[model samples]
Target: MTTTALHHRIDGPDGAPVLVLGPSLGTDLHLFDAQVDALADRYRIVRFDLPGHGQSPSPAGPYTMRGLADDVVALLDRLGMDRVHYAGVSIGGAIGQQVALDHPERVLSLAAMASAARFADPESWPKRAATVREKGPDAMVASRPGTWYVPSFSDTDEARRLLSMLRATTAEGYAGCCEAISGFDVRDRLAEVRVPVLAVAGAEDPATPPQMVRIIADSAAVGRFEVIEDAAHLLNVEQSEQVNGLLAEHLADAVAGSRHG
Candidate 1:
């Protein structure tokens, strides 16, 4: 299976510990702007765009979570990174799970925000993929505002920025990622993850509710779950301060654990 060399940008100190950030489907690397700003001083922040998103090449159809996780490992290999702290949202979060399960030694810790071990109603993802393949990413834009954030955030600049990213996403890229998500299910494999996991959920997230996020925390060998109030699917964007604080603590704890281990 050929892997895509995903487009990426790096921030923070040159030799600091690496922290990789993955964005949700339809969004690009910019989705982690807040996290980069908050953590760049201490960690080498690497943010990558999924296939067909941002400047990444839009390859053909049918991507798998394992394949996507392999692409990430390829990126790490190219960058000469032995291991990293990982965090992701939505499909990105799913990819994080796959990474930890598939390449346990490469991941120091994982923070999955607004994601699930197995997405609910797995069949619906392919249908969404078909819709995007037929009508393009624009077809999904109308419903995203509600599913992505609370009603009060709709008109804000941050909200608009995210929406713009969705509108700009290529149909092939968006649909292929959807196809990857459709077949994703790691509920039974969480027991294999040796690294620490932090599952953050938006209290009001309709897409992947708190219960879904909790499953990852409950199943993993070392896991913790948290819920942010008045947020939805994009909790990191909607509640950046709170999310950032949680991440800071999570990463710090991981570092301390590694030192003591």
Candidate 2:
């Protein structure tokens, strides 16, 4: 599959191990601001925006999971990163899974946060794509508060900033990702992922609940599962300190395991 030139930002010292962070759909790389701030001192953090989400240029519609995964690999190649630890939220997590499944050698570890091995029924995504194309990204804005965070967090300034990202997302870009998600189903292939996997779920997340996230942990060769209370789909943003602690430990363990092996 052809790769898209995804827009990205790099942080941390030159010689540190590379750690790639992927953002959920609608939100840009800034979705990982908290993680970047906490981990950049020890890891070379690379955060990227999906096609047309932030600074990335809008490409044609109907992208695939493999295609999005390829875009990440292309970015890694450009940055001269041979292998790295990866963590992502929602659609970003799906892409991380795809990368692990397709290019295991390039991933040292995987953290799937508020994500799933398979998103909702495949048919629903195309319909969502159609809605976005017809009404623009604004159409999905109303439902995000309920699905993305708890009622309390939804009304905060941080939540408003995230919602603005969805509003600003181009119809074609958002719809294209929706189509990509429609075709994404890696449940059966989870066992093929050899790297260690950390699957996190938000206790209040109605989108990808703990049950859904647990499937990833149960199926992967080396996996762990954890749930954070009082958060929803965008748990990393809502529970930054806890999420950062988990990631720090996961990355450290993976590095140590690699060294011993």
Candidate 3:
């Protein structure tokens, strides 16, 4: 909701079609590190940390999903980018949907991973925010392993690294995002999205189930759904190869469709 500059990294070939990657709450741009490393050769990858997370400065108040979307559009404007393909996971995905709705002219396509049009059960978000606000990021980090990843992948080195990223985020930033998720609902507007959209879900993700993502795909004018096998919430990190492949294919398809249209 604040107009402060967000911490962003722009990489890949200059002048290549831009791909903007947003991060989930409790995480930062590192959420897309594997994707950026793999896709940078062919695309211009621009990723940013949420306000109050990573290197970005904290906002004065809590943020709305649409407000975060506006920050991205403003960032794109500052970078002289008029349009870019967008992708995000969890809260990041919610922001993507908002961008497609709030600033359709700025987005060429969308890839929403492990995200839903709305959180079907938002009852726990208040308590989550309160805990992080009182006890700090540790409270959220300690409670995320189960909801964030499946039990099997939760013990891996990469998983631990991601957990570390979560731990490093600011309590105020994480709490603000939890507040955003608590009241988020955009299902009625899903059909309003006109771009080619790809919705991805982790089969084992209890936080936002595949069915929730499917609603996004089913409601969009142009959309598709892909469920990463044996993965949980952070499917992009857990099944990087498969998730990256799906993104590559979707981006390619979107590009081709754009040219044809």
Candidate 4:
């Protein structure tokens, strides 16, 4: 319920290290709900709605990946956070990559989940963006489940929650993110990421897929990869425990290394 230019919320131990969690395009900061209780004990968790999603107001029209990444830096500056550990899913992960590339000093570590250096086919995004722009969010709902989750997860409470998140999202916001993702090709620059980058994949995710994530891991100078089974695009929610454990370890190690070295 707190308001900012970005609409953020912070919780967990007061003096703990900062951990900023970003959301995929369809959902807001709530995408990390399942991971919060598990990691909050050790981190000051900052979660926020991206522009035009949930509580955050959208900018006029289209948004670039770099633009969104800069918005995050602004949020950190607004809160007096010099640097922080960053984690995100899908579009969120893409933003993390941009930050690491463009604003290296601001990231302690990165957890890039269910994301890739580039979308499988870059051309597909503008088409999708155009559809949402013309028809609206409902135009995307019909085919989302196929890429978002395994067939079995489509009926669960979490699935319903995600569906609602998608519906509640503004078409312009979603389309803007699509434009961002469409042009996002950071593969050539991955070696420039100085911080540790942990790339995570859902084994069954048809969206970004495992191969895409592995490429991210291989591309980064200090990247590592993990694949969680029985999950799809929304791996953090479907396999929350496994993803949380991976993230907790990555963040801890990153923090320890940053301080010690």
Candidate 5:
């Protein structure tokens, strides 16, 4: 793996087309562990923690999802990649959607997992954002693991590790991202997305449920939705195998289409 001072890590082969992977809020590029392993042989994977989330420097915020989308574009330009297959989970999904919408030529295909075009009500998310900003993600986990994972899924070690990651988020970065999501609304612009899209939602995800995924999928002219069984909001992690399989199948078809074109 190779990385720049900007905190983006470029792994896998040099000649392969890149697959830019973005993680959910508070988490780092580690969110793509399962997908990376599965796709490493066929594609070069580029994964990064957003600024302030992982190794990336935390610039003081009041940030927006569009701003984060710009960061991804910058990363691509820095790598000299004209276009790439983009995949993201949750907030990361919002970022990918913005990038594809704003910079269409830079995106070859889009896969949004467990995300919503518009964020939920501020009243519902405000307290959680405040608690995370002030006390960190741990407080929220104790209070509402349901936002990130299902009840039964939270009993395992993986669940503990994932929750700890959210709890360890830096106040500036986490709060900024929350603020970004608070005002996020991309419903009207979904029709502008001309790229092929794969919208994945967790079957048990209360955050961005299956119906919400359908809304997103339906909005795009060329989009499909898939629900991963027994998974919640953090489907990419909790149901990695199923998610990875779906991703592999979609990516294979995407790559083949690109080659033919």
Candidate 6:
């Protein structure tokens, strides 16, 4: 395993097929614990805490999505991973999209989970941005529990644990992610992405919602969408079995696509 100043932690069997994972905003790499266990034997899974979250120290105000994309590239360079299969949820997805568009050769297959192609709604985001900046990631938690987990899942220990992670995020880091969200505009760049893409949407996802996820999946020329039943925003956590199965299938296709094209 390797650690960096950016606080990125990468593990799983070395020299196995690489899959770089980006977690949801407000939460850290723990969100991917279940996924790592499922695929670690066969894949070198790389997961990291974005700047200012988890072990990563907070950065000064206002970082753009492009800036976070640069951070991913830097992490890959540090790890000597020339190219990798990319998977991201929420803010991580947005960063992956930019990376694929801006640095195509570094990406093998791209999977975006509960993420948008662009900030579809502009008027509603500023207040959210302000909240994170002033009150920190914890402030966003009260309103997020139901939106992030399925109805039944919300009451479980796993849900509370995940919520704790989200609530623990620093204001600077969370706001930085929100800054990336606000500035993210990759609609025109989707056509430029030559990589195979998979969009995973939770059927009950309220944050990005199913319709919004569909629009993102449809926007890509070579993309498909998979819906996980009885899941919310955090589909990977709420519906582990279904999400893992879809990941296995989509990642295989992504690898095949890379070989052919």
- Best candidate, TM-score: 1
lDDT of each: 0.93, 0.93, 0.88, 0.89, 0.82, 0.82
Model 2, span 1-261: residue lDDT tens: 357899999999998988999999898999998998899999999999999799887898899999999999999999899999999999999999999999999999999999998998889998999998999999998899868999989779899999988888889889999899899999989999988999999999999999999999999999999999999999999999999999999999998998887
Q: State TM-scores per candidate.
A: 0.99, 0.98, 0.97, 0.96, 0.93, 0.94
lDDT of 1 by residue, 1-261 (tens): 369999999999999889999999999999999999999999999999999898888999789999999999999999999889999999999999999999999999999999998898988988998899999888988898779999999999999999999988889899889889889999999999989999999998999999999999999999999999999999999999999999999999998898798
The digit string of per-residue lDDT tens for model 3 on 108-219 reads 9999998988886687887888888889888767667767888887778988888888888888888888888878899898899999999999998988899998998999
TM-score leaderboard ranking: 1, 2, 3, 4, 6, 5
Q: Is candidate 2 or candidate 5 better by lDDT?
A: 2
| Residue 17 in model 1: lDDT | 85
Error of 3 at 3 (Å): 2.0
Give the residue spans of candidate 6 off by over 4 A: 1-4
lDDT of 5 by residue, 146-214 (tens): 767788877888787786667666777777778778878889999999878999998888888888877
Cα lDDT tens digits for candidate 4, 1-261 = 122288899989988899999999889888899889899888999998987789988765567888889889889999999889999999999999999999999999999999988887889888988998899888888787768988899889998899899888888888888888887889999999989999999999999889989988898888899999999999999999999899988998999999997
Between 1 and 4, whose lDDT is larger? Answer: 1
* lDDT score, candidate 5, position 9: 82
Evaluated against the true structure, the overall lDDT of model 5 is 0.82
| Model 1 stretches with alpha carbons more than 4 Å out | none
Point out the worst 10-residue segment of candidate 4 by lDDT.
1-10
- Candidate 6 lDDT over 1-261, as tens digits, reads 122256776677888889999988878988998898898887899898987778987767577888888888888898889999999999889889999988988998889999988755755566677887777777777887668887788789988888888878888777767776887888876888777788999898888887877766787778889888888999998888888888898888877777787
Pairs that collide, model 4: none
